[model samples]
Every structure is written in structure tokens, then in C-alpha cells.
Target: MEDSDDFLRLILDSIAENIAVIDEGGGIRFVNHSWSQFGSDNACSITQDWSKMNYLSVCDSAALAGDEFGMLAGNGIKSVIDQKEAYFNLEYPCHSNNEQRWFIMRVSPFELNKERFFVISHQDVTERKLAEKAVEKLARRDGLTNIYNRRAFDEILSEQWQQCLTLKQPISLAVIDLDHFKLLNDTYGHQIGDDCLIAVSALLKNFARRTGDVCARYGGEEFAVIWSYTTLLEALVLSKALLEEIRQLKIPNERSPIAPYMTASIGLVEMTPNRILETRDLIAQADDLLYQAKESGRNKVSSLIVVPSSAVENQN
Candidate 1:
């Protein structure tokens, strides 16, 4: 009987699935060698109890069990504890060797001690998940500026509005226009004009170094930036600095009818909390400010503040 038990153990250990025998009470009774080698505990589970393992704490069994993937794995361990049949697929994201990966898991129930136990199996599926994400990113990103496209910008701004309202945070919007851009195109030709756009796009991205900050080309010779969790003063300072940087571009616009150098004008506005401002209203305010900067004189920055239910007001 001892030799027969040892032979059975060897066969179970040789199979890929992590074979672990647990009592009806959810304790780690026995673990196969294969199971011990690949489980996510970093080899800390050789002599450790399953209840004490760190990986189980963060496991989202509820989310996994109800989804299609989870259904394939069988009832989750939770069901097993309740003496009910369960299955699930557990996706574990792991970081190792400076790379990230996901392990697809299968968990099911079995009989042990005349009660109920569970079996969990997993396989690495990081490559598939990464490929899907890569495809999604390529679809969402703009080919020219590498920023979010207008469609993405529109959707994200709407989402940001809700987030700001919920968090009671401030939001800001800005409109940027190239000074004498038409003449630059006529003189330097469209090729150099496109280059100018790329350069300015890079500048805007550099200035918007926050998680919720978004920059995009609104259209020809024009761009827009959305700033979340920022104040009017912060937005104004950023616009001023960016305007100055573009003024100093010195792109050799000698062939243009305007200034000998290339430059841009900026207009921005901040949305305070508790105000009911629409995205269009924010955009219109920035556009009006852009015109104000252009009318006052080219190559400068102008900003305005608009109360949700009131008219536009000038900010110092």
C-alpha cells in the first residue's frame, strides 16, 4: 500500500496542473511538486499553509467566478467551502525579470475526507493580453501627434467632467493657435508647416505632465489641452510659459508675411467646482480668449473665467 501511494503521488506530481489536497475546511493538506513549483507564492508555500499564502488575499474570486473565463474553471473555492460545486478562471498578473505577465487559472471542487476540496490550475497568458492592449492603443492614438485623437479627446473629456464633479476637483481647458500660420504655410510650404505643428505638439505634451492632462490637435493650426485637478493660476502659468517657448521657436519664417520667426498664441480657462459648465461652453470660452489674444496682438496668451450661470469674467 505504501509503494502504491508513492507511485500515485509521483504520477500526480508529473502532471502540469497544481494538485493540492485540502480538507473540507479549506486547509492545504497536501501539495504536488508541480503545484509547488509554478504557484505565485515565490516558493514560499513549500511548507506554508494555504490560508497563510499572500496571493489569495488579493484574488478576486467573485469577479472571476461570474465571468465567462471563470465558468470554464468550475466553481470557485468559495462554493467549495459552502459544500456547493463551483468553477472559475483566475487571472493572475505577475511581474518578473523586468516583464509583466498574466496567468490563466482553472479552479474546481473535488471530494476529500468525505467532504469537499478544490483543485487549481494555471497557465501563463501574458502575451495574449499584451497583444490585445497594443491593438487597442494603436486604435485610440493619433498617427500624427501621437496624442489622443479628437474622438478620444471628446470621450475622455466627458468622462473627466463626471470625475471632477464627483471628486469636487477643478478642471481647465485651453485653445492654442499658431500666429500667422497661413503665411508660414505659403512661404515655407506645407512640409515645414507640418513640422512646425509636430514641434508645437511636442511642446504642449511636455507642459501637460500630469496623469489626467490631455493634449490634442483640435484642427489645422489649432490645438486643445484638458487639465484636470488644476487651478486657474496653474493653468495660466502653464499657458504663459508655453506661449513664451513658441515665441522663441526661431523657425526661420523668412518666407512668411508675418514675423520672421514662428510663434503661437494660447487661451485657457479654469472650471471651478459646483459650477454647471458644459464642454462646449468651456471650449467656446477658450476660443473667445484665443481671439482676444490674437486681436490684442499676436504671439501672446490670454485667459478668461466663466461662471456656470453667469457671463464671462476676466482673471488677473
Candidate 2:
């Protein structure tokens, strides 16, 4: 029995992850060498004679402190100890002053001589977590302007639509188009055109300050903004401000009649939950209004608030 215990401790010390064994009573039975080193390296105030510290008590303290993740951890640990769950796993950030870190906590229950014990392991997963974040960032962002991509914008619109449906709030969308952009592109070559697109995208992105606000490349020389919880007048004012900001860019477009510098037009629609559910209709309406902006002469904004009674009744 003694030799077996020594072998187990030796194996635990060899591994990297911090490992500890806690009994059913929540008493810390044992902690491996790596566990002590982790606390020392992180300047954790937890003592080496971990028996003096109760894992369950730490979780309870965290929960009382109103840490959501800590509450989850406490619940997960209880589930394992009660044999209600096979194992508990949680990935969480534990950044310290010296280093940004993330860890994967795993708790598995085992029985020896009819006595229950839970093996807790903490594995450093910072590199993997950071890499995953980088990949996710790339997936959701536009390559050109480093703003949300069209796909992300669509996702946000769908989410906001659902929220508005439930809360009966208003959401607005604005379609922005560069006037005579094709002429500018044809005259100055694609490089300058690309520069203009980047600059304009940056400007539009800056306008998305509010939560759930999304600015995306709708298509070539065109951008779109989804503004959640906005009224018709608010949408119109924002669109007009965006139009003015684009003109202020002052990128010369001699080929256009609107101005010596570049200009953009905006078409906006503010819809409430008591309106049609067809997001496509909203886009089409905005597009039609954008055509009107171009026809009425560029460098302007056009907006409308619409409600389809039939859809509103269905929604109700």
C-alpha cells in the first residue's frame, strides 16, 4: 500500500498540470508538486499544507463574491461529488499581473476502498485560448477595414430582430453608397479606389459606438449599418451625420458632379416589432431609397418608418 501511494505521488509530480485530491467531505487530501509550484509562481496566498484549505469553501467564497464563473464551478464540483455527473470541466481566465493566463479546470470522482475522492486538475491553456480567440476574430472581421464582416452583420441583425420581436423595441438599418464610385474607380485605378473604400469603411465603423451596432461591407462601394433600439428620427439623424462625415473625407472625385471631393448617400429604415418580419423587405426598401438618393442628386440621406398591419397582427 505504501509503495503504491509513493508511485502515485511520483507520477503526479511528473505531470505539469496542478493536481489535487479532495475527499467527499471536501477536505483537501493531497496536492501534487506542480500544484504547489503553480501557487508559488502565481503568488497565490494558498498555503502548501493544502489540507488547511477546503476546495469547496473556496468555491463558496467565490460564489458569495458574485462571480458567475465561480458559482458555476461550485455547482459543477457539487455535481461531481454527488455522483450526479461524470466529470466537471471549466475553462476560465486567470490573468495575473505578470502574465495573461487561462486555465482548464477538470474534476473527476474516483473511489478507493469504498471511499470517494475527487481529483481536481488545473491545466494551463492560455496559448490555446489566445489562438482560438485570434481565429474567431479573423472569422468575424472584414479583411479590408478590420471591422465586422457582412456575415457578422447579418448575424447581429437576426439577433436584434429576435430581441425587438420579444421586447417590441425599434431597430434601424441604413444602406450607404458612394456616389459615382464606378467613375472614380475607372479614372484613378483600383489602388486609389481601394484606399477610398478603406477610409470610408473606417469612418462608418467609427459610427458604430453603441452596443449591437454593426457596420459592414454590404457590397462593392456600399456599406450598411444596423442600429438597435433606435427611433425613426434617430436613424435619420445618424444617417445624415454619416453622410456628412463621408463628405468630410475630402478624397477628390473630379469625375462626379456632387462635389470635387468624394461623397456618399444614405437610405435608412426604422422598423418596430409591430412591423413586417421580412428583413429582406427592409433591405429592398433601403435600396430603393438609395436609388432615390442617387436620382435626387447624391450626397444626401433618405429615410422612412414603415409598419405592415398584417404582420403586426400576426406578431401580436
Candidate 3:
């Protein structure tokens, strides 16, 4: 029996995953060698004597401090111990100061000497998670300019609209159209036109540095910008500056009647969200204003603020 116990311990200690066994009351009864190594690597103070501690108590303390993963882990372990669940698993991030890391925690029940115990194991899965993130980013990006594609733009606009509505903050939208783009493409080849688009997209990136700001390729020669928690006056000021900067790029467009260099028209709109309004309504208003700007002059900005009828009546 002594030799059998030592053989079992040797096998458990050789496995790479961190493994621990806890009794019915959640008291840590055994831990493999990898468990001690993991604790030391993470700078855990209690690694020296894990058998003297209650695993559930540690999870409960972390839960009280508002660690969401701790709460989830504690509940999952309890479900297994109570026989309500045959197995349980959870994937969570456990990033260290020097590197990002992810792990999958699993719990399973076992019978030992007429008593029930749970075996917990944690396995590293950071590589898989990072690959998934890279794939998602590629799906959301435009092929030509490398900015966000139209599909991503629509999704992001809807998300930002809801967030701004919930926070009772203002949201702004800007629709931009390059002036006489077809003429430029006709004069210089499609290659130069593509280069111009890339340059403009790069410039747009600078304006979207704030959190919740998004710049996307709406379509050929068209782009859209969403600004969360911004007012009409603020968006208008930025729109005017964007026009000036595009002109400064001095991408020659001798064929354009409006100017010797390339320019753009912008339609800007701002609104404090309400239940009666939808995201499409905001896009429609901006599109109409953009058309008006093109009709009046090719290189200018037209802006409007949308307010609820009740608010307008109160002001009157």
C-alpha cells in the first residue's frame, strides 16, 4: 500500500497542469507539484502550505472584493461538490504584469476511500484566444484602406447609440464624401486614387483617438465618423478642421472644378438620444445634410442639432 501511494503521487506530480484535491467541505487535501510551481510563479504567498487552507474560503474572499472570476469559480465548484453538476469548467484571463495569459479551470468529482472529493485543474490557453482575436480583427477591417469596413461601422454605430442613450449623453455623426473622385480617377489612374484614399484614411485615424470614437469606410469615396459624448458645436469645429487638413495634403486634382487640389463635403449631426428615435434616423439626417452641402458647394460642412419636440416647445 505504501508503494502504491508513492506511485500515484509520482504520476500526479509529473503532469504539467496545476492540480488540487479538495474534500467535501472544500478543505484542500492534496496538491500536485505543478500547483506549487504555479503559485510561486504568480507570487502567491500561500503556496508553501496549501493543504492547510480551505480553497472555497479563498474564492469567497476574492468574490467579496468584486472579482467576477472568483464568484464564478466558487459557484462552479459548489455545484460539483453538491452533486448538482457532473462536471464544470470556466475560461478566464489571469494576466501577469509582464505577459498576458488565459487559463481554463475544470472541476470533477471522484470517490476516494468511501468519501467524495473534487479535483480541480487549470490549463494555459492564451495562444488559442489570441488567434481568435486576430481573426475577428481581420473580419472587421476594410480591404482597401485598412480602416473599419461598412459592416463593422453599422454594428459599432448601433452599440455606441445604445450606450450614449443609457448614459443620457450626446452622440455626433459625420458623413464625408470626396469631391469629384470619379473625375480624379479618370484623370490619374485608379492606382493614384487608391493611394489618396489610403492617405485620407490615415488622417481620419488621428481624429478618432478618443475612447468610443470610430472612423469607418462607408463605401467608395465615402467615410463616416461616430463621436460618443460630443455636442453639435464640437463636431462642427472638428469637421471644419478636417476639410482644411485634406486640402493641405495637396493631392492634385486639376480636373476638379471646385479646386486644383482634392477636397471633401461633410454633413454633421448631433442629438441627445431618446426612446422615440432610432440609429437609422440619425444616419438619414446626416446623409440629407451631406447632400445639401454638395449642392450648395463641394468643400463645406452643413450641420444640424436634433432635439425632441417637447424640448423645442419648452424653449419657445
- Model 1, runs deviating above 4 Å: 1-25, 39-76, 79-86, 90-92, 96-99, 109-117, 155-163, 180-182, 254-258, 273-275, 278-280, 291-298
Each model's TM-score? 0.72, 0.80, 0.93
Q: Model 2, 75-115: lDDT tens per residue?
A: 99999998899999999888888778899999999998999
Ranking by TM-score: 3, 2, 1
Every model: Cα RMSD to truth: 5.5, 4.8, 3.1
Q: Which numbered prediction scores highest in TM-score against the true structure?
A: 3
Encode model 1's per-residue lDDT on 1-316: one tens digit a residue: 6569899888888886666655545456577776677655564433545554423322345346554433433336556556554565667665676688777776567774686666666666788999988988877777777777777778888888778878988788888898888888888789998888888888888877898898887888888889998877788888888887886777767754457888777788878646556777777878888888888776777876656666454532
lDDT score, candidate 2, position 172:
85
* lDDT by residue for model 3 (93-144), tens: 9999998899999999999689999999998889998899899999999999
Task: Evaluate model 1: give its lDDT.
Answer: 0.73
Candidate 3: residue 276 Cα off by (Å): 2.2
State the displacement of the C-alpha of residue 108, model 3, in Å, after optimal TM-score superposition: 1.2
In angstroms, the error of model 1 at 237 is 2.1
> What lDDT would each prediction earn against the true structure?
0.73, 0.84, 0.91
Residue 49's lDDT within candidate 3 is 90
Rank all candidate structures by their lDDT, best first, as comma-separated numbers: 3, 2, 1
Clashes within 3 Å, all models in order: 8, 0, 0
